[model samples]
Target: MSKHGFFQITQKLFLRDGDKFLVMRDRKSGLGDLPGGRMDEDEFFEDWYLSIKREIREELGANIEIEVNPKPFLIHKHRVNEGNHPCVIIGYHAKLIKGKIEMSDEHDFMEWVDVKKYDPTPLFTEYMLDAVRVYLKEYA
Candidate 1:
């Protein structure tokens, strides 16, 4: 909603650990999700990378160490909640530099999924699976 208008902008990271990437289970939806969220209103003024870092810290914990590629690997636009709200999600590639993953309240579980052997689950949305495939094609 910044100067950009009505659509909400979200940033998601494919946090890599070797051939695997991290995914979390949303507490509410029971869906597999990535490790980022909507950008805060104030964050619109700062660099997008900072917003991404902040989201990772908030979701995965402040002490978690990781390195994110500044360049985004995927961009997707979709409607949220039965098409009531529109969103644009930007996805990036990152690597776990150190520290074990700790879950935040928003998510109940976390797993490192091997991209090469990934199988689609009902817990993942099509775009989520597509994002993984995109990562495999370009980054992995």
Candidate 2:
């Protein structure tokens, strides 16, 4: 694998429904993470909001409408593919405005977690738990 490149920015959507936030079981890893993906190279809407919005539609279905908070709540940095490439993960808070989730094949399962009380051991990364802590502290 070639390793020469800039950091890949991924937008993680923290979708809130009342007191719970959504998490998806990654098909490849089996660990839970926020619903989102890599940011596309966009010229018009360079911000991650549009990229995440598109991701939500593609992952959750086109019928869903999301209202993403203007600013990102968290920023995490890590290496991808076992250090093959660097990555920067931006976490955003979004509210589901309409439509029910239509799970894509990308993930094996989905869950709504009450981060304040739920155990986070099932999540993929330490950052995932950390994200939850921050979310609960700020939003809850």
Candidate 3:
């Protein structure tokens, strides 16, 4: 990795049900992404699990029950805010324990896509798809 710019650390959820994974269309980028965001400045690194849970509750509503892995499933390096803006994405795998999804204003669209059937190209990054594939091989 190049030390060319500042890093924007974010946690992303890869919520899965059987062969399907939950993805939300970003309002700003008009691209599919996991339902998560940057942790607050005051938040501690030790609270990653709780922080993601809070984020999911806020973005997906309080009615849903999701079980997240205690540790991150994958990490990806990408450029946002154009092409050279450095970002480190920490991805976590989650399973929906109960309740149907309800979208919040943060995202414009939400869908459950079957990894084997869905064409993730152009919609998601290669790193993301690779991670999901690894996850599926392990859990699916």
Candidate 4:
């Protein structure tokens, strides 16, 4: 293994409500992102579900209950801008099981988008666009 040993692992949720999917504009980056974050140091890789739930609770709200699919539909590897560190993003399909959306400071705006009609190019990164394409072709 290289000195860097491991890549940062991030879990993203494709939270769908009928025909639309949730998208949020990050407060810091000013870029659109899916609802999720990097796995914490204390989190076990095997317990991705719990990590995802925790991320959702933190980024969205603790009152929200999202049913995340354990299997990831998309995975992408890239270097994050923050530290020029290699990262792996795992995307999963999810549904809103309960509660209302209460935005956290992490995001500035939230919207439900119909991928078929919306162009993600302006708001998201290429890797995120790749996930959107996969979602449209296979899952949507």
Candidate 5:
């Protein structure tokens, strides 16, 4: 948790298997979301990518590469409570490169769902669903 104005980076990974996009799922919540995490005060974007890549590798064991896409599909600004404790999330697209998924403790399991029938559950906030819809449209 860095006091820096910005502290997180999100990526949209499109895992292709033959002619399909591989969307991941949460083990416990069972919601499809991007592979991303927070950036420390000492870490930059590149460092964040490496750290998150390692995390994704460890969590899902998926071969992932950071896609050079500056444009974020959803730049959501949300706060559960107005306090000094600031919490925010910014999501972007980062397509998958290679590798198979292996669930980690962070999630109960994972899923490679079809984009056409993609649906968000109660676990995912509206902001996250916004990002998914954007990806489905562009890739579908």
Candidate 6:
């Protein structure tokens, strides 16, 4: 059987402290991941943007505005989150439009880690970080 591909949606949250991006830690996975999820069937990208925005709000409790295909990262990739479903993560540069972050059940916590500080860990797949590395060099 051909592998069923789910439409993965993710928002890249970026706040430049001079020149770095804000990355989040998924509490369930204990790994660094951007804010995103799968697109409901037939959901348009613009509508999906709001879905992503709402998700991040509920998770981090911050007002964020996201633009689709907003500077694509080499980060559009997948990882195994659940044994059954592949996580399709997309990266986008986001500006913090409002508020402070308070973690919800989804993530252990959050941080404004520097881009240069990213290191691949057991929790976070190397493919994801590899995307970050590609974005850094390609965009820089």
The top-ranked prediction according to TM-score is 4
- Model 4 TM-score, 2 decimals: 0.88
**C-alpha TM-score for every candidate:** 0.86, 0.82, 0.80, 0.88, 0.59, 0.70
* RMSD, candidate 1, Å: 3.5
Q: List the residue pairs that clash in candidate 2.
A: none
User: Ten residues in a row with the worst lDDT in model 2?
Assistant: 77-86
For lDDT, the strongest prediction is 4
RMSD of each: 3.5, 3.7, 3.2, 2.1, 5.4, 3.4
* Candidate 4 clash pair list: none
Candidate 1 worst ten-residue window by lDDT? 77-86
| Global Cα lDDT for candidate 5 | 0.52
TM-score of candidate 1 on Cα atoms, chains taken together: 0.86
Candidate 6, poorest ten consecutive residues by summed lDDT: 64-73
- Provide the overall lDDT of each model, using Cα atoms, as 2-decimal numbers: 0.80, 0.76, 0.74, 0.82, 0.52, 0.59
Better of 1 and 6 by TM-score: 1
The parts of candidate 5 lying over 4 Å away from their true place are 1-7, 11-14, 25-32, 45-48, 62-97, 121-123
Q: Candidate 4, residues 1-140: lDDT per residue as tens digits?
A: 55746888888999988788898987887877889988888896467788888888888898887888899878987555567678788989999877899999989999988857877778888676677667777766
Pairs with backbone N, CA or C atoms under 3 Å apart (clashes), candidate 5: 12-93, 12-94, 27-108, 27-109, 60-102, 63-98
Question: Which 10 successive residues of model 5 have the least lDDT summed?
Answer: 78-87
For residues 1-140, what per-residue lDDT tens digits would candidate 1 score against the true structure?
55755987889988889988787887876777889988888999899988998888789988789999898878987444334468788988889999976678989988887777776465577666676567767765
State the lDDT of candidate 5 residue by residue for 5-120, as single tens digits. Answer: 73234333444554455455555455555555444445563545555556556666665443434455456543222232334555555555555555566565455666676664
Candidate 1 segments exceeding 4 Å error: 1-5, 81-84
Summed backbone clashes in each candidate are 0, 0, 0, 0, 6, 2
